[model samples]
Target: MKFAVIVFPGSNCDIDMFHAIKDELGEDVSYVWHDETSLEGFDAILLPGGFSYGDYLRSGAIARFSPIMKAVEEAAAAGKPILGVCNGFQVLLEAGLLPGAMRRNSKLTFICKQTELEVKQGDTMFTQSYEEGESITIPVAHGDGNYYCDEETLKNLQANNQIVFTYKEDINGSIANIAGITNKKGNVLGMMPHPERAVDELLGSADGLKLFQSIVKHWREQHAITS
Candidate 1:
């Protein structure tokens, strides 16, 4: 499968994302600049972590307006899977592609460390490889990662199984300990944790590999790719 790793001016994780897919997963991947107009020929889109636009005015507020975001909207409308990690999650929220908004950590500090997350469900293409209630370790680095949404929205998300992952412990003070979530259509996922950073054993854990594997597996199944 081919993946496009969107790159903004301050996208520090672009290379890491590209490496995860290309080097580790052995997939065709490319770095698509934030100003690019189209995402043609890519099976999936990955919004990597970083302080986009220096996070000057809120984490993803400014970066959401990058020229490539228009194409991102178009791609989302076309039903291509979109995975946003860390600041990417903030971008998705700011762009209105996903539900809820982020707030400063409950502790009012930047958090950087390995976190345990419980897989709530495996219905989406992003988590089909994980079982319900399975716990996995992934690194999270963010200051404004606290997730908040209205009670009604949270209820709806729960009823629809949109909540994908939750922190095993209350680390960031996210509402209901939510660590990750998917769009209503399940093709788009936004999360505070950095899954791409955990795909290698040398780095510590390979738990995040299955998230990518699930994407490729589900995509191939849908496309009937026999190879």
Candidate 2:
């Protein structure tokens, strides 16, 4: 499946995402600038981590207005897989594509380290390669990674099985240790961990590669059905 790695100004992890998809995952991937208006041919959309617009107003706050986001929204509405990592997660929240909001880390510090995460549910497109309750290591780097949703939203997320991954420990003060979550439709995923960075064992882990593989597998299945 072909993928588009959306690049906004000051985005640093776009190349990492590209490398993970093209080199490691053996998929067709290309960098799409933020201002572009079309995403007609891509099978999936990836929003990589970085301080877009220098994180001036807020993490992902400015980048949320990028022209590409409209196309991203259309993709999501069309049931195309969309994965947003780190600041990309923040952008997703800002765009209201997924529920919840991010806040400053409880300790008020920038954290950079590998975090152990548990697969909350493995049936979704993004986690199909993983088993439920399985543990995997992925690196996270961010200062405002705390995730909060109202009690009603949390209950709905739980009821719908939208929560995808949770930290083994409270790494960033996110409610219920949520490390990642999918939209109600189960197509869009937003997470704080840098899965692209961990796609290579040489980088200390290859656990993240399963995520990309899962996406590809899902796409193939869907395509086969529709075609």
Q: What value does the lDDT take at residue 91 in candidate 2?
A: 95
Clashes of each: 0, 0
Runs of candidate 2 with Cα error greater than 4 angstroms are 225-227
Instruction: Point out where model 1 deviates above 4 Å.
Output: 225-227
Judged by lDDT, which candidate is best? 2
Compared with the true structure, what per-residue lDDT tens digits does model 1 show for residues 8-107? 9999999999999988888899999999999999999999999999998899999999999999988888899999999999999999999999999999
Query: 9, model 1: CA deviation in Å?
Result: 0.7
Question: Any idea what lDDT model 2 has?
Answer: 0.95
Question: What do the candidate models score in CA lDDT, each in turn?
Answer: 0.93, 0.95
What's the residue-level lDDT of 156 in candidate 2?
A: 97
How many clashes (backbone atoms < 3 Å, residues ≥3 apart in a chain or on different chains) does model 2 have? Answer: 0
Note the residue pairs that clash in candidate 1: none
